[model samples]
Target: MRSRLLFYWISSLLVSGCTRSGSPPALSFSGGLVVAQIVTDSLQLVDPTRQRRIPLVRYFPQPGRGSAHKLKVALLNHAYHGKNTDYKFLADNLVAHGYYVISIQHELPGDEPIAMTENLYQARYPNWERGVQTIRFVLQELAQRQPQLDWQHVLLMGHSNGGDMVMLLAQEHPELRQVQQLISFDNRRVPFPRRPYPRVLSLRSIDQFADAGVLPTPAEQTQFGIELVQLPTTIHNDMWDGATEAQKQQMNAAVSHFIEKK
Candidate 1:
C-alpha cells in the first residue's frame, strides 16, 4: 500500500512538471534564437538599369536587431537554375546575427539561361555584368526604401554560378566598397580577386573542382587572409535547400561564425 502511494505521487509530480501551472507546455525555440521575417514584400522589383524585373527574398529579424541604429546588409545570389530562396538557411543565419539579407534572383523568366562555354571566364562576362548591374540597382533601391541600414558594412554571399557573380561584382563597378565580407559557395570559374578590405571566403564542395586560378594560392590566401573551407561529403548541389541537416548545420555555423567577427 505504501509503495503504491509513493509510485502514484511520483507520477503526479512528473505530470505537473511537464505541464506548466496546469497549462500546456509552451512551444520553445532555442534560447537566443532570433525569429526572422520571411517574404515580407513578395514583390518583383523593376531594375531600369538591367531593364529586367528582379525578384528578391528578404529576411530580417522580426523586431529587427539594432533597428535604432543602422543594421548591416547581406546580398545573397543564387546558383544557376536555383531560385532566390534556395539559400534561406544562410539568410536566416545572417538575420539572426543582425543583418538584413536580400537574396536576388539573377535569372528571370524568359531570360537567357547560363550555359557551358568554351572559355567560362570570357563567356560568362555578360551574365556576370548583368548580375553586377542588378546588384547595383538593388542597392540603390534598398537605399531609397531603407536608408537606415548601414551602407558601409555589407556581406556578399552566393552559391555556384551566383558565387561567380558575387566575385565579379566585388571586383568590378562601384568596387563594392561597403562589402566587409565576401563568400562564395563552390564557384568554379571566376578567379577570386586579391583584395584586402572585404575578407574573402570560399566554401568548396567535395564533388566539384574549381577551374585553375579560380582559387587563391596558399601563400596569396595567407597574405590576403582568405578563408577556404572544404565541406566533407557536401556536393555542389547540396549547398542549397537540398543539404542534409548535418550539412546545413555545418555550413550555417561556419558562415555565422565568420560574420560574427567584429
Candidate 2:
C-alpha cells in the first residue's frame, strides 16, 4: 500500500511538472530577505489504512541575490505541543545561510496536548510510518523542482520525538540515499532499530533529557553512530524561549556551526 501511494505521488508530480514550470513565487520574511513556501498537493499517507493531502511548508532563500549553494533540509517537530514555532528561529538562521528548510506538521487529530500525547505510539498511530514515507517522497519532489539543489547534501533535523522518527526513517529507507546528515535536539533515548547513515549529530541540553537519565544506552548510541554534543547551560526550552538577545545568538551560533560545518 505504501509503495502504491508513493508511485502515484511520483507519477502525478512528473506528469504535472511541479518543479520545472517556473520559479515559485518568493515570500517575504521578517527580515529584508525573501522566502518561498512551496505547497505540494501530492500524496499523504495518513495511516496504514488511509491517505490524505500532503502539506509541506518550506523556507527558501531569495534567488540571484547570493551564492548558489543548495542544501535541502527537513525539520520535524517534537512531541505533544510541538509545532514549527519551536524551529522558526533555527529555520530562519538556516535560510540566511542559503539552505532551503522544509518542515512537516505531524497528523495529530487535534491541537490539544492530551490528544497529541495519545497519538505518539507507533503501534497505536500507524500514520507514523506514513509520515516517514512522506518525508522521503517530499525530498524527491523538491529535488525535481529545484535543479540547482545538490540532492546529495540533504539533511534531516528533528526535535524530541521527531528526532527519534527521523533516526528510524533513515535506518529504514536506505534506498532513498539522499539524506546524508541527521540532527536531533533534546530527544529522549530510544534504541535505534538499525545503523543510521555516517553523519549523525545529536544535541541535548546538559540537565534536560540527559539528566532525566532515560536516554539510549551507551551500546545503542555506539551502534547508531551518533556524534552526541551536549550544551551545558542551555535548557531544553532555551531554543524556543524568549531568551536574551545575546543568549539566543549564542544558541544559534552553536546550532549553525553544527549544520554548516563540512
Candidate 3:
C-alpha cells in the first residue's frame, strides 16, 4: 500500500538567505556562492505496524544553481520536546547549499518524559531505540516519495537529545550504510558509536558537558577518525534557532565545511 502523504507544501522565497535577515548575502556552497531555489513541505509518515506517526518538515532543493545536480540528503532530528519546525534556520542553510533537508519529529504527545537519571545511557534506551525505528520508517517511505534524491550521501544531524539519535541510528543499523556522515550538536548521552565508516563530526558547546563516556577519548577519536570541535560561544539550548547570528555563522561554517570537504 502507498504511504499516505499529508501534503502542505509551499514555494517560499528564492534565496540568498543564510540568516533570518531582511536581505542577506548569497549563500556559499562547496562549489561556490550560487543562487538556489528551495521549497518547504509538511507531511507525516504513518507506521501502520508500529502504530506511530512521524511528522516531517521537508526543505527541498529545487532546480537552481546548487540543486541542478543530484541533491544530497539530510535528515534532521529534533531535540526532546522540540517540534520538527525548530530547525528551519539550519534547514534553510542546508537547502541553500544544495541539500534536501527533512527534519523529523520524534516526540508525540502523552509519551513518557525522557529519563534524567544518572544512568541515562541505559535508562533512555527505549527512547533512542524507538527513534531509529521511526527514522527507518521515514527513510523507507521517503525513498518511495523522493526516489530521485541522492540517498548514498544521506547525513544525519541533530541537536542535544536529537544529536544522540545520530550515533544510535548508525550504531544499531550498520547495514544502513548509505548515511555517509554523522554530525551531532552536543549529544549528552550514549557513547559515540565506535566505527570507522560513516564519518563523525560532533560540534560541542562550551557551556555544557556531556555525560561521562558519552564523548570519546582523544585516542578513541583518532582511532575512529572523529572530528570534535567545541563552539566557545554557543550553549546547549541555542543549538536550534536560539543561536545568535555570530553563533549561527560559526556553527554554519563548521557544518558546511564538514559536509562539503568530501
Per-residue accuracy of model 2 over 122-215 as CA lDDT, tens digit each: 3423444555766766666667766677677677877766665676676677775767777777655333334556467666664554322334
Candidate 3, which segments miss by more than 4 Å at Cα? 1-28, 31-34, 63-67
Per-candidate TM-scores read 0.83, 0.64, 0.86
For candidate 1, lDDT tens digit of each residue in 1-262? 0000000111111000111123222211223433423323345799765468988877765443223545579999998888997876676566656677888988877877665858767888888888878888888888888887888888889898888988888777445677778889989888888866688887877788888877888777778878787777689889997787668777776675566666
Writing each residue's lDDT as its tens digit, candidate 3 over 1-262 gives 0111112122232334433225445565665535444567789888999888888888864444453467778999988888898877778778766688999999998789889867788888889888888888888888888888887878899888888887788888889989888889889886778888788888887687887777777777779888787777778888887777667776776776677775
Q: Is candidate 1 or candidate 3 better by lDDT?
A: 3
Question: Each candidate's lDDT (Cα)?
Answer: 0.71, 0.54, 0.76
For candidate 1, the C-alpha RMSD (Å) to the true structure equals 12.8
Top-TM-score candidate index: 3
Model 2, residue pairs in steric clash: 19-145, 189-215, 189-216
